[model samples]
Target: MLPSTDALLDGLLDWVRIETHTPDTAGLNSIMDLVQSQAEGFGATCQRFPGRDGKGDHLLVLSPWGDHAQKGVLLLSHLDTVHPRGTIEHDLPIRIEEDRCFGPGICDMKGGAFNGLAAMRAIAESGVTPPLPARILFTSDEEVGSPTSRSLIEDQGKHAKYALVTEPARNGGHVVTARKGVGRFTLKVEGRPSHAGARHWQGRSAVTELAHQIIALEAMTDYDREITVNVGEITGGTGTNVVPQFAQAEIDLRVPTAEAADEMVARITGLTPKTPDTKLTITGGMNRPPFEQSDASKALFDHASTLAAEIGFELVGEKTGGGSDGNFIADRIPTLDGLGPDGDDVHTLNEHIFVSSLKPRMLLLKRLMETLS
Candidate 1:
């Protein structure tokens, strides 16, 4: 039996009350405890992997019927949000306004996580063991690039035949079949320092060189190929009196394919300093590979489309420039993403999910889990 709206709302509200900011491992651990208890209530055995690099640990919940040989479905989600601990109390309070539920992280992910849990419970109550076993992975560092959870996500992706990411549905109820690869690079320039007023001509301005590099980097953006480069942050110079001896630029890169990622990295690294006295060095490369559309992914989308129609909602797939752990898993498996409920104003004080979407999306998830192999 599917959980009632009151029951679902109560649960979601409870979850939204607890804030699991990306850097708050202790808070994340508390929420994971709640999620573990919920999953275990549905007969899923929970496993914990300790977090690294000061992030919260990860939880893997395996359904009672899961077996080593099944190579089943992987349901992916994250517990961390971009909001800090006090947002719930200060900026975004828990409130139900007409058809929407307002709170931080409510639309960004907690609502999706709640719906997913509800679907699992419905499955358990239905007495139908799915043809494909299921593993639900709740990661803790996704808001900050998923540094600790990437390897674990990939390892599970290798075992699963299909992956469904419960990220919030995009605007207009579109699911994601593709996501751009995301990466970061830092360029540092070392130059000779001299007194600004006394020996300006003797000094090599690292800031000047970095400014030139930023222009060059920004020019690398190719809208036609869906490639973009941004020099998002830069810092240099000690004081007004000093000609900076060192400067650095932090760049953000996005690409539509692995080949594009490689080519962009090469281009960035191959940059030659126009200034004679400065030496430049580059660091960092691609983080997540692009989730390009594949035949297998398209077939998966077709399966989901039929299931959505049976559930009485039209479904469509979209491509996005943003990257997620979905990007990490898609390169290895047939991944279907954005299966979460509809929402708007994600990652803001106005963040909210459609209250009306909870049950239908839950039912849709239940049907897909029950029917998909």
Candidate 2:
């Protein structure tokens, strides 16, 4: 059964109203407190892990009655929003008009967190046990790729039988079964400097050499294999009259599979510049590994889609170039993500969540959790 659509909407409204940007430590803590209080009221046991700054914390809520030694499913969410603390000054005070709910972080994730709590709350109120012993992990820093909470996510994920991440879906209403790998690399070059007007060949132009490497990298992109190498940022040169002594560039690559990732890494690391006059230094590696689909994950998706079909919506899946917390967990265990409300224009003022989808997705989550046992 699905959660009451009206109740889910009201809960999401309260959630987005809190300015819980992880960077804003105070705001993050306050939001965590609000959630902690709510979970406690549901009789869920909760614990907080504070960060280095003593500001933000990761909240873990467990089934009220469970054996500590046994591992079970872990549901993941984050208490932080991507917007700044003051974003509420403008697009805040969430408004629900027709089929959409507009606000900061409404669709990206906060809505998903609400669904997790609702499912557990429904069970708790009914005095019924969940499908299994469960763990709800609410992290603090997901927008920036879980810099601090990543190890903890993997640690808990390894113990659980399965993991569910609540990142929003690409299409308006669906879930993710796989995601491409993401990598960040820097290509730097050093050359001799001289007066361009007086001595042309006396200096090796680092900028010129960097241009060759950039072109070479771009040439490696193969659409057939779904590989993309993007030269996102470049900086070099001192003056028009002087040969540039140093040049640097940032590279972003997205690949579909581990084999593709390995192939790309080797090719990128061994890039030989056309101009040997400049010394090339490339430093960077895969930050997030690919969340390739596995047979187990596919079965889980089938189960979820079956549940969705039983409800009312046709279920489908898609592959995304974007990376999420799911990528990190997928490396060790079967994971499914992109399970939040539908929306677009995240990280901008125009961000909005489909008001109509919120309740349905919550219902989806509720039904799925019940089946997990």
Candidate 3:
């Protein structure tokens, strides 16, 4: 049975009501229950692998028509979101204003995930056996860089012939073909502390050293290769009257290719402390390699575009600086992303999905999955 618009929206609302922030193991498991229940209803077998670092277990649902022994299509998505608890009740209370449905994670993910479920449902109801095995992997961590789920994703990518990611469709209905690689880094500086008034010259300020590092890091951004280095967060200092002895900075880096990523990391780590007495420590590296578009990936995109055209819409692929779990899988298999319903303002209280876009997106996904061999 094709899902009615009401049913899809109802499912999206039901899933969105649960706040499965990245670190909330219980919350991620709870949302997985909802997802697994639907998958099971379609005759898919489910397995749960325990997560590390206090995250929820990763859930895998295999269609009865497919098996791990054979290569097939992999549906990739994350169950966790960026919004914390109380977002639904206090911040964006679930509401529909004309064509837009406003709620946390609705656009960023939950909506696209619901499309996955709906597509599988339609295929199962049609009773058409897929030519190859199909698998659905629901990870508990994606927003936090998939630290725990990286290996699992890579393993699955190795077995799958293709990967379809449910990250939100880019604005203007563009699908993602390439994404910049992501890296997380921390910079710390240690210096001698002294009373600001009593011996200002006697103290080397760590904060001052960190400030210089931030400038140097920002200067590393190269638009030519789409390399961007941002010091997203920083902390230091003890009191107004004391020269700070320690300071730290958290950086976010994105590069267009793996070679550029390596070069960028090498340069960042090679930085020298300006103050002679200050000691600097740097940690963390690339999280996901860039999703470079290859001929195989382009072929997959072309197929999806053809399928999209059948649904009466022209699909165009674009490169994005934002990274997804697709960044991990794309390098391994033919991956096509941004297969979710169109939406905007993700990671914010105003996040929402276009209510009108849900049905067509689901249909498109259903067709693509059905066409997979």
Candidate 1: list runs displaced more than 4 Å: none
lDDT of 1 by residue, 97-156 (tens): 899889989877887777877787788877888888888899999888888999999998
**RMSD from true fold, candidate 3:** 1.2
Give per-residue CA lDDT, model 2, range 1-373, as digits (tens). 4457787888877878888776788888878888899999979899888875433788988866556456677788987888887787765656766877778888778888888888777766766566567778888888776888888888888667777877776676768888999888999999999999999789999999999999999998999989999999999999999999999999999999999999999999998767767798999888789999888888778888988888788778888998887888786676778877778777777778887777667667767766775
Candidate 3, superposed: residue stretches over 4 Å from native: none
Candidate 1, run of 10 with poorest lDDT: 61-70
Is 2 or 3 the stronger prediction by lDDT?
A: 3
| Tens digits of lDDT, candidate 3, 260-301 | 999999998888999879999999899888999989999999
- TM for every model, in the order presented, reads 0.97, 0.93, 0.97
Local distance difference test values of all predictions, in order: 0.88, 0.82, 0.89
Q: What is the C-alpha RMSD of each candidate to the true structure, in Å?
A: 1.2, 2.1, 1.2
What residue pairs clash in candidate 3, if any at all? 66-133
lDDT of 2: 0.82
Best by the lDDT measure = 3
Rank by lDDT, highest first. 3, 1, 2
RMSD of 1: 1.2
Candidate 1 — what's its lDDT?
Answer: 0.88
